[model samples]
Target: MVTKSDTNSVQVEIVPSRFLMPETAQRLLCEIYKNGGIRRIMIHGPNMPREVPYGPGKGIPIEANRNLLVEIGDQAIELRVKVGRIRLEMESEDYLGGLKAACERALPFSFQFRQGKFFHDRMTTSDYAKYGKVEDERILGLIDPKAKKDKLAILSEDMVTFKEDEER
Candidate 1:
Protein backbone atom coordinates (compact mmCIF):
# COMPACT_ATOMS: atom_id res chain seq x y z
CA MET A 1 0.00 0.00 0.00
CA VAL A 2 3.03 2.25 -0.32
CA THR A 3 2.69 5.28 -2.56
CA LYS A 4 5.14 7.65 -4.27
CA SER A 5 4.81 10.14 -1.41
CA ASP A 6 5.45 7.39 1.12
CA THR A 7 8.68 6.57 -0.69
CA ASN A 8 9.84 10.08 0.23
CA SER A 9 9.81 9.15 3.93
CA VAL A 10 13.30 9.88 5.26
CA GLN A 11 15.06 9.91 8.62
CA VAL A 12 16.12 13.30 9.84
CA GLU A 13 18.74 14.11 12.50
CA ILE A 14 18.80 17.79 13.28
CA VAL A 15 22.16 18.88 14.71
CA PRO A 16 20.17 20.05 17.76
CA SER A 17 22.03 23.37 17.41
CA ARG A 18 25.30 24.26 15.69
CA PHE A 19 26.65 22.99 12.40
CA LEU A 20 30.30 21.95 12.12
CA MET A 21 32.22 23.31 9.17
CA PRO A 22 35.57 21.61 9.02
CA GLU A 23 37.98 23.96 7.27
CA THR A 24 38.67 20.99 5.05
CA ALA A 25 38.33 17.22 5.33
CA GLN A 26 41.97 17.01 4.27
CA ARG A 27 43.03 16.47 7.88
CA LEU A 28 40.80 13.40 8.12
CA LEU A 29 42.25 12.19 4.84
CA CYS A 30 45.79 12.55 6.17
CA GLU A 31 45.04 10.60 9.35
CA ILE A 32 44.01 7.50 7.37
CA TYR A 33 47.44 7.04 5.88
CA LYS A 34 49.42 4.19 7.38
CA ASN A 35 52.31 4.86 5.04
CA GLY A 36 54.22 8.11 5.01
CA GLY A 37 53.29 9.14 1.52
CA ILE A 38 52.15 12.52 0.37
CA ARG A 39 49.78 12.71 -2.56
CA ARG A 40 47.70 15.32 -4.35
CA ILE A 41 43.93 15.58 -4.35
CA MET A 42 41.44 17.89 -6.03
CA ILE A 43 39.13 19.28 -3.37
CA HIS A 44 36.22 21.49 -4.25
CA GLY A 45 35.59 24.68 -2.34
CA PRO A 46 33.76 24.59 0.99
CA ASN A 47 29.96 24.47 0.93
CA MET A 48 27.99 27.61 1.74
CA PRO A 49 26.53 27.29 5.23
CA ARG A 50 22.75 27.04 5.36
CA GLU A 51 22.09 29.25 8.41
CA VAL A 52 18.45 28.18 8.34
CA PRO A 53 17.69 26.20 11.50
CA TYR A 54 17.97 22.55 10.54
CA GLY A 55 14.77 20.67 11.01
CA PRO A 56 13.11 17.81 9.20
CA GLY A 57 13.46 18.12 5.41
CA LYS A 58 16.42 20.48 5.59
CA GLY A 59 19.94 19.67 4.43
CA ILE A 60 22.60 21.05 2.11
CA PRO A 61 24.89 18.84 0.13
CA ILE A 62 28.33 18.23 1.63
CA GLU A 63 30.22 15.48 -0.22
CA ALA A 64 29.18 12.70 -2.52
CA ASN A 65 28.97 9.11 -1.30
CA ARG A 66 27.43 5.91 -2.54
CA ASN A 67 23.67 6.07 -3.24
CA LEU A 68 23.68 9.87 -3.20
CA LEU A 69 21.61 11.68 -5.80
CA VAL A 70 20.97 15.41 -6.27
CA GLU A 71 17.94 16.51 -8.22
CA ILE A 72 16.47 19.95 -8.72
CA GLY A 73 12.74 20.09 -8.10
CA ASP A 74 10.41 22.84 -9.27
CA GLN A 75 10.07 24.10 -5.69
CA ALA A 76 12.68 22.43 -3.50
CA ILE A 77 15.72 20.21 -3.98
CA GLU A 78 14.99 16.51 -4.18
CA LEU A 79 17.69 14.43 -2.56
CA ARG A 80 17.37 10.74 -3.14
CA VAL A 81 19.23 8.34 -0.88
CA LYS A 82 19.20 5.02 -2.66
CA VAL A 83 19.01 1.82 -0.62
CA GLY A 84 22.42 0.72 -1.83
CA ARG A 85 24.41 1.05 1.42
CA ILE A 86 21.64 -0.57 3.48
CA ARG A 87 22.04 -3.84 1.57
CA LEU A 88 25.82 -3.77 1.31
CA GLU A 89 26.36 -5.05 4.86
CA MET A 90 24.02 -7.98 4.40
CA GLU A 91 25.98 -8.96 1.29
CA SER A 92 22.71 -8.47 -0.47
CA GLU A 93 21.86 -6.31 -3.45
CA ASP A 94 18.15 -6.85 -2.88
CA TYR A 95 17.26 -3.76 -0.90
CA LEU A 96 13.49 -4.02 -0.58
CA GLY A 97 13.70 -7.80 -0.46
CA GLY A 98 15.48 -8.27 2.88
CA LEU A 99 14.89 -4.90 4.56
CA LYS A 100 11.17 -4.97 3.82
CA ALA A 101 11.09 -8.41 5.37
CA ALA A 102 12.90 -7.07 8.41
CA CYS A 103 10.51 -4.16 8.70
CA GLU A 104 7.64 -6.63 8.53
CA ARG A 105 9.11 -8.56 11.43
CA ALA A 106 10.42 -5.73 13.61
CA LEU A 107 7.81 -3.04 13.09
CA PRO A 108 4.29 -2.86 11.69
CA PHE A 109 4.06 -4.37 8.24
CA SER A 110 1.53 -6.70 6.72
CA PHE A 111 3.58 -9.69 5.69
CA GLN A 112 4.75 -13.14 6.79
CA PHE A 113 8.20 -14.69 6.41
CA ARG A 114 8.79 -18.16 5.09
CA GLN A 115 10.64 -20.86 7.03
CA GLY A 116 14.44 -21.37 6.63
CA LYS A 117 14.56 -17.92 4.99
CA PHE A 118 13.57 -15.47 7.72
CA PHE A 119 16.83 -16.22 9.54
CA HIS A 120 20.00 -16.31 7.51
CA ASP A 121 22.87 -18.34 9.04
CA ARG A 122 25.23 -16.88 6.49
CA MET A 123 24.69 -13.40 7.84
CA THR A 124 24.60 -14.23 11.53
CA THR A 125 26.45 -11.04 12.33
CA SER A 126 23.51 -9.04 11.05
CA ASP A 127 20.89 -11.67 11.82
CA TYR A 128 20.05 -10.01 15.10
CA ALA A 129 20.45 -6.60 13.58
CA LYS A 130 17.81 -7.60 11.07
CA TYR A 131 14.43 -7.83 12.77
CA GLY A 132 12.83 -8.31 16.20
CA LYS A 133 16.36 -8.13 17.54
CA VAL A 134 17.79 -5.27 19.50
CA GLU A 135 21.36 -5.02 20.63
CA ASP A 136 21.88 -4.69 24.38
CA GLU A 137 24.48 -2.02 25.04
CA ARG A 138 25.26 -3.64 28.39
CA ILE A 139 26.96 -6.46 26.54
CA LEU A 140 30.04 -5.63 24.47
CA GLY A 141 28.44 -6.70 21.21
CA LEU A 142 28.97 -6.32 17.50
CA ILE A 143 32.35 -7.07 15.97
CA ASP A 144 32.46 -4.37 13.36
CA PRO A 145 29.55 -2.00 13.00
CA LYS A 146 31.79 0.79 11.75
CA ALA A 147 32.85 -1.18 8.69
CA LYS A 148 29.29 -1.30 7.45
CA LYS A 149 28.71 2.38 8.15
CA ASP A 150 31.23 3.50 5.55
CA LYS A 151 31.26 3.15 1.79
CA LEU A 152 34.14 1.67 -0.17
CA ALA A 153 37.41 3.51 0.19
CA ILE A 154 37.87 6.11 -2.50
CA LEU A 155 41.00 5.48 -4.61
CA SER A 156 41.15 9.25 -4.98
CA GLU A 157 42.63 9.41 -1.49
CA ASP A 158 46.20 10.66 -1.15
CA MET A 159 47.25 7.45 0.63
CA VAL A 160 46.37 3.78 1.01
CA THR A 161 46.59 1.03 3.61
CA PHE A 162 49.42 -1.41 2.92
CA LYS A 163 48.57 -4.68 4.59
CA GLU A 164 50.84 -7.70 4.81
CA ASP A 165 48.93 -10.59 3.29
CA GLU A 166 49.64 -14.14 4.48
CA GLU A 167 50.95 -15.10 1.06
CA ARG A 168 53.55 -12.41 1.36
Candidate 2:
Protein backbone atom coordinates (compact mmCIF):
# COMPACT_ATOMS: atom_id res chain seq x y z
CA MET A 1 0.00 0.00 0.00
CA VAL A 2 1.43 3.35 -1.07
CA THR A 3 0.85 5.95 1.60
CA LYS A 4 1.27 9.69 1.11
CA SER A 5 4.61 9.67 2.93
CA ASP A 6 5.78 6.75 0.79
CA THR A 7 5.28 8.73 -2.41
CA ASN A 8 8.31 10.55 -3.81
CA SER A 9 6.47 12.87 -6.15
CA VAL A 10 5.99 16.54 -5.31
CA GLN A 11 2.98 18.63 -6.26
CA VAL A 12 3.15 22.30 -7.08
CA GLU A 13 0.55 25.03 -7.33
CA ILE A 14 1.11 28.38 -9.06
CA VAL A 15 -1.30 31.25 -8.61
CA PRO A 16 -0.55 34.36 -10.58
CA SER A 17 -1.45 37.81 -9.34
CA ARG A 18 -3.87 38.06 -12.25
CA PHE A 19 -5.45 35.62 -14.67
CA LEU A 20 -3.11 34.72 -17.47
CA MET A 21 -3.89 35.76 -21.02
CA PRO A 22 -3.88 32.95 -23.56
CA GLU A 23 -0.53 34.00 -25.01
CA THR A 24 1.08 34.18 -21.58
CA ALA A 25 -0.41 30.86 -20.54
CA GLN A 26 0.90 29.28 -23.72
CA ARG A 27 4.39 30.57 -23.13
CA LEU A 28 4.36 29.42 -19.49
CA LEU A 29 3.07 25.94 -20.35
CA CYS A 30 5.57 25.57 -23.17
CA GLU A 31 8.45 26.49 -20.89
CA ILE A 32 7.33 24.07 -18.16
CA TYR A 33 6.93 21.22 -20.68
CA LYS A 34 10.41 21.87 -21.97
CA ASN A 35 11.77 21.15 -18.48
CA GLY A 36 10.53 17.55 -18.78
CA GLY A 37 9.64 16.54 -15.20
CA ILE A 38 5.92 17.13 -15.10
CA ARG A 39 3.87 13.98 -14.58
CA ARG A 40 0.48 15.67 -14.63
CA ILE A 41 -0.77 19.23 -14.97
CA MET A 42 -4.15 20.93 -14.59
CA ILE A 43 -5.33 24.49 -15.07
CA HIS A 44 -8.10 26.23 -13.15
CA GLY A 45 -10.21 29.36 -13.36
CA PRO A 46 -13.75 30.61 -13.88
CA ASN A 47 -15.50 29.17 -16.91
CA MET A 48 -16.18 31.57 -19.73
CA PRO A 49 -19.79 31.14 -20.77
CA ARG A 50 -20.14 30.13 -24.41
CA GLU A 51 -23.45 31.92 -24.62
CA VAL A 52 -25.26 34.44 -22.48
CA PRO A 53 -27.02 32.10 -20.07
CA TYR A 54 -29.76 34.65 -19.24
CA GLY A 55 -30.77 38.31 -19.36
CA PRO A 56 -31.33 40.32 -22.56
CA GLY A 57 -28.77 38.37 -24.58
CA LYS A 58 -29.99 34.90 -23.66
CA GLY A 59 -28.70 32.20 -26.05
CA ILE A 60 -26.52 34.68 -27.89
CA PRO A 61 -22.90 33.71 -28.45
CA ILE A 62 -20.51 35.73 -26.38
CA GLU A 63 -16.97 36.71 -27.27
CA ALA A 64 -15.01 36.41 -24.02
CA ASN A 65 -11.72 37.52 -25.62
CA ARG A 66 -10.04 34.30 -24.59
CA ASN A 67 -7.73 32.84 -27.22
CA LEU A 68 -8.95 29.29 -26.39
CA LEU A 69 -6.10 27.80 -28.44
CA VAL A 70 -2.54 27.33 -27.30
CA GLU A 71 0.24 25.09 -28.49
CA ILE A 72 2.58 23.09 -26.25
CA GLY A 73 5.22 20.82 -27.71
CA ASP A 74 3.60 21.68 -31.05
CA GLN A 75 0.24 20.21 -29.97
CA ALA A 76 -2.68 22.61 -30.01
CA ILE A 77 -5.06 22.49 -27.04
CA GLU A 78 -8.29 24.30 -26.41
CA LEU A 79 -8.56 25.79 -22.94
CA ARG A 80 -12.10 25.88 -21.60
CA VAL A 81 -11.29 27.94 -18.53
CA LYS A 82 -9.71 31.32 -18.03
CA VAL A 83 -6.36 30.29 -16.51
CA GLY A 84 -5.85 31.74 -13.02
CA ARG A 85 -3.86 29.00 -11.38
CA ILE A 86 -1.87 25.95 -12.40
CA ARG A 87 -1.37 22.76 -10.40
CA LEU A 88 1.06 20.06 -11.42
CA GLU A 89 2.64 16.90 -10.12
CA MET A 90 6.33 16.39 -10.62
CA GLU A 91 8.48 13.29 -10.31
CA SER A 92 10.56 15.08 -7.71
CA GLU A 93 11.60 18.47 -6.36
CA ASP A 94 14.80 18.51 -8.43
CA TYR A 95 12.96 20.30 -11.22
CA LEU A 96 11.38 23.01 -9.09
CA GLY A 97 14.21 25.44 -9.77
CA GLY A 98 13.79 25.11 -13.48
CA LEU A 99 10.06 25.55 -13.11
CA LYS A 100 10.60 28.76 -11.10
CA ALA A 101 12.92 30.10 -13.77
CA ALA A 102 10.39 29.30 -16.46
CA CYS A 103 7.72 31.18 -14.55
CA GLU A 104 9.99 34.14 -14.01
CA ARG A 105 10.69 34.39 -17.72
CA ALA A 106 7.10 33.88 -18.81
CA LEU A 107 5.14 35.90 -16.24
CA PRO A 108 5.54 39.65 -16.15
CA PHE A 109 3.82 39.97 -12.75
CA SER A 110 4.06 38.32 -9.34
CA PHE A 111 2.86 34.79 -8.70
CA GLN A 112 2.83 32.35 -5.82
CA PHE A 113 4.51 28.95 -6.05
CA ARG A 114 3.59 26.45 -3.40
CA GLN A 115 4.34 22.78 -2.73
CA GLY A 116 1.72 20.51 -1.25
CA LYS A 117 -0.74 17.73 -1.99
CA PHE A 118 -2.96 19.63 -4.41
CA PHE A 119 -4.15 16.52 -6.32
CA HIS A 120 -6.04 13.43 -5.29
CA ASP A 121 -3.53 10.87 -4.02
CA ARG A 122 -5.75 7.88 -4.67
CA MET A 123 -8.34 7.03 -7.26
CA THR A 124 -11.96 7.16 -6.16
CA THR A 125 -14.96 5.06 -7.20
CA SER A 126 -16.03 7.76 -9.60
CA ASP A 127 -12.64 7.57 -11.30
CA TYR A 128 -12.84 3.80 -11.64
CA ALA A 129 -16.38 4.08 -12.93
CA LYS A 130 -15.31 6.61 -15.50
CA TYR A 131 -11.91 5.31 -16.57
CA GLY A 132 -12.22 1.66 -15.51
CA LYS A 133 -9.25 0.57 -13.46
CA VAL A 134 -6.80 3.08 -14.86
CA GLU A 135 -3.19 1.88 -14.57
CA ASP A 136 -1.68 5.33 -14.92
CA GLU A 137 -1.95 7.15 -11.62
CA ARG A 138 -0.72 10.31 -13.28
CA ILE A 139 -3.95 10.55 -15.25
CA LEU A 140 -6.35 10.00 -12.36
CA GLY A 141 -8.44 13.01 -11.31
CA LEU A 142 -7.12 15.00 -14.28
CA ILE A 143 -10.30 14.75 -16.32
CA ASP A 144 -13.93 15.55 -15.81
CA PRO A 145 -15.89 12.30 -15.67
CA LYS A 146 -19.05 14.01 -16.83
CA ALA A 147 -17.47 15.36 -19.99
CA LYS A 148 -17.93 13.36 -23.17
CA LYS A 149 -14.16 13.11 -23.57
CA ASP A 150 -11.09 13.62 -21.47
CA LYS A 151 -9.24 16.93 -21.76
CA LEU A 152 -5.87 15.33 -21.01
CA ALA A 153 -3.15 15.63 -23.66
CA ILE A 154 0.30 14.13 -24.07
CA LEU A 155 2.85 16.60 -25.30
CA SER A 156 5.43 13.89 -25.78
CA GLU A 157 5.74 10.61 -23.93
CA ASP A 158 9.46 10.71 -24.32
CA MET A 159 9.58 14.00 -22.48
CA VAL A 160 8.45 12.48 -19.19
CA THR A 161 10.35 9.17 -19.45
CA PHE A 162 13.72 10.81 -19.12
CA LYS A 163 15.23 13.99 -17.70
CA GLU A 164 16.50 16.53 -20.19
CA ASP A 165 19.91 18.16 -19.88
CA GLU A 166 19.81 21.07 -17.39
CA GLU A 167 21.29 23.53 -19.85
CA ARG A 168 18.58 26.09 -19.36
Consecutive 10-residue window with the lowest summed lDDT within model 1: 11-20
**Candidate 2 residue 163 C-alpha distance from true site, Å:** 26
Supply the TM-score for candidate 1. Answer: 0.14
Clashes of each: 0, 0
- Give the backbone clash total of model 1: 0
Best by TM-score: 2
Q: Candidate 2: global Cα-lDDT? A: 0.74
Relative to the true structure, candidate 2 has a C-alpha RMSD (angstroms) of 6.4
Candidates' C-alpha lDDT: 0.24, 0.74
The deviation in Å at residue 7 for candidate 2 is: 4.3
Top model number, lDDT: 2
Where is model 2 poorest over a 10-residue stretch in terms of lDDT? 159-168
* Candidate 2: Cα lDDT at 129: 76
Error of 1 at 167 (Å): 33
Q: Give lDDT tens digits, candidate 2, residues 57-85.
A: 89888776434777778566667678899
Q: Please state the error at residue 29 of candidate 2 in Å.
A: 1.0
